[model samples]
Target: MGSSVDAVVAPRGVVDLRGEAGAEFVAAYPADAVVVVSGLPGAGKSTLLRRWSGAARVRTVDPRTVHEACEAVMPAALPYAVYRPWARLEHFRLLRSSVRRGGPLLVHDCGSRAWMRRWLAREAARRGRELHLVLLDVGAATALDGQRARGRHAKARVFARHRRGLERLLAAFTRHVRSGGPLPTPEASSVLLLDAVSRSRARSVEFGAENATR
Candidate 1:
């Protein structure tokens, strides 16, 4: 195991990256911390991870990647819904295994499941790491356009449900940022809130500053 950790590190609440102009945001964390990237469907989570300019010193866990791999082997006429459960199960298994490895991680989530985050927090804490969050705040129209661009679409009701989950998470972070109270996230150390501009302008998410050069 790595060195022991006492508590969540500095930058303990929300770091809102929305209003800053001109500078690209570079997120820094401990060498093996867990960073979760969350937003609504089509919020560019996958694209952002793919666009990392620096050498990747972290492992990324993307559900879309899992789904696509499964889709490729699936029968053409079978809708994704038919095998959705299996894909989700695979994703969970992969994420769990990845988390257990105890290296830096970048995860993609929709902010829809409190239990998932809670479990992640527990696991990270057990491993002497902290869970960080990166949230992309975007409008419904923009998300839909993203889906169309990628040839994937979330049903209206499903999108609405995701939106609600995001709203709740955002609200919790908002309160955390404003009041400096207990974090809604179990054992989560920090969160970075980003709007479309900031999200587009972000340069990279680095595990540790040393990785940027390596």
Candidate 2:
């Protein structure tokens, strides 16, 4: 049943950022757009944001940065669990502050958290702005490799949960596209999917005319 629905709603215009052509697509992206960079924990979202950090109109917020800051104040041997709640509090506090400021923003997200997406969508709506998603479609093995390379590892169970949730989100996105139905969320204007290879070759994320007014 679900498979049939997915077939009907498969995305038709998903851009593949694989080569020189992909650079053109990135160039056309709208500036002043509110975008979420979502993927597994280690899928290079922070790296991508760093690449765009120099843009005058772009402001980025990543929870991991908060987590790292919290870690610095504690014992080197202490586990993250001890201060996890404080990290979460600080992260959301910053997000809320960003939303209030109302400018072009980029946020890092692990694709599993539906509530966070919904919250972002609501904030966008309230601000009369549209939210966009840049989802990295790297496989679990590659994502795990990324985690190891970064020297940060999510628990096995947590990683499994993230995989399941991301799969469901991708499926929903595909189905919505194939069906030509209303957008998954009125506040969300588009979703862009990229693979690991494509992500590596991409140079910049440019904002187009759509961002001119904002």
Candidate 3:
């Protein structure tokens, strides 16, 4: 861990890491900062979150875990889509509860839901904590490879939706930065963009008072 993002610090803005290589990122911020790890369906958002959560010793509101718990008690023949609504509700509830308690929370988001992003950013602001984005910008082909690698294939339509959402999001962020307009979303003070290479290169994400969680 040799580099810092300075994401929510002075002159707060986007901290792009797409081109960085050979540097293990140590994303440091306030102990209370809320970070949203976002990307397409196969962009490895959950994987990165799992790694960072262990390293940062931070609690995360991940819907996948909720799905797993729900799956454990349900009939084996039933598809996850049948109970997705309940899972979503449970995830939302957990996220709200976690945010209320507050202090260096990491959220796994697919970047496909604008409303969720807005809500997260607002909730963080309400708690006097900054909301930052750590987006994995790996493109479509690579993302699809990731899905196959994980053996979790997102439906085609859903994957397309996520891709489009991510494209629009990145475009909006670019325009905002170029025009010096408002942030991409509510209460989002900074965004850190990373690609597959950079994400892998990042060893850990540390939150306040730096401890070697590895």
Candidate 4:
């Protein structure tokens, strides 16, 4: 009976060994690493990752999918909205195994609050992996201009979401820079901040500049 138990548990021990030594063994198994790209709408997060494709980029449609999933589970508007944030948490967990294996960045396009970004940083630190942020510091005026120039299909639900999201991004930016937090810097890892106003015709002209290098 003791021999049988040992045989049954030996495989689990090997699995634990693989999991604990993930940093080294990840190379053999091909794990996925996600680099969250966040900014206000028209900040070019999508364009950046799309232009420079190497690893697999996974997307999280928290705003839309999470809402739908919530309705399915709860069948009430209040609970759906209230528990939406928790539902999005699943994305982080899904990336854990992939992160250990280390593959392509899971590009997160949604505009997350600054505090949320800090939380994500903590998660990255605990996992022994690096967290990089690409902050496209386009001013509100510029963002508004970009939005106005957008095609009919590109218009989002309302101006409120952008306004609120912008406020959050700016506040987060201030906290990120001055708070002495783990926010990525050029020397630490890589935090690239591009000024959109410095370039014109942002869609093709200015955006093209970065693409040219790629």
| Candidate number with greatest lDDT | 3
Clashing pairs in 4: 31-101, 31-102, 31-103, 32-98, 32-103, 33-103, 34-106
Question: Candidate 2: global Cα-lDDT?
Answer: 0.69
Off by over 4 Å in 2: 1-24, 27-31, 55-57, 211-214
Name the TM-score of candidate 1.
0.85
lDDT of each: 0.77, 0.69, 0.80, 0.42
**Ten residues in sequence with the least summed lDDT for candidate 1:** 1-10
Off by over 4 Å in 1: 1-11, 210-214
Please, what are the lDDT tens digits per residue for candidate 2 over residues 59-127?
Answer: 899897899899999999988898899899999999878877876788998867878888988887787
Scored by TM-score, the top model is: 3
Q: Write the per-residue lDDT of candidate 3 for residues 156-203, one digit (tens) a residue.
A: 999998899899988887787668687676457778788988888666
Separately for all candidates shown, the number of backbone clashes (residues 3 or more apart, or on different chains) is 0, 12, 0, 7
What's the ranking of the predictions by TM-score, best on top? 3, 1, 2, 4
True-vs-predicted CA distance for residue 177, candidate 3, Å:
4.2
Pick by TM-score: 1 or 4, better one: 1
lDDT (C-alpha) at residue 149 in model 4 = 66
Candidates in order, TM-scores: namely: 0.85, 0.79, 0.87, 0.46
How many backbone clashes are present in model 3?
Answer: 0
- For model 4, the stretches where C-alpha displacement exceeds 4 angstroms are 1-34, 54-87, 95-98, 109-112, 145-188, 197-214
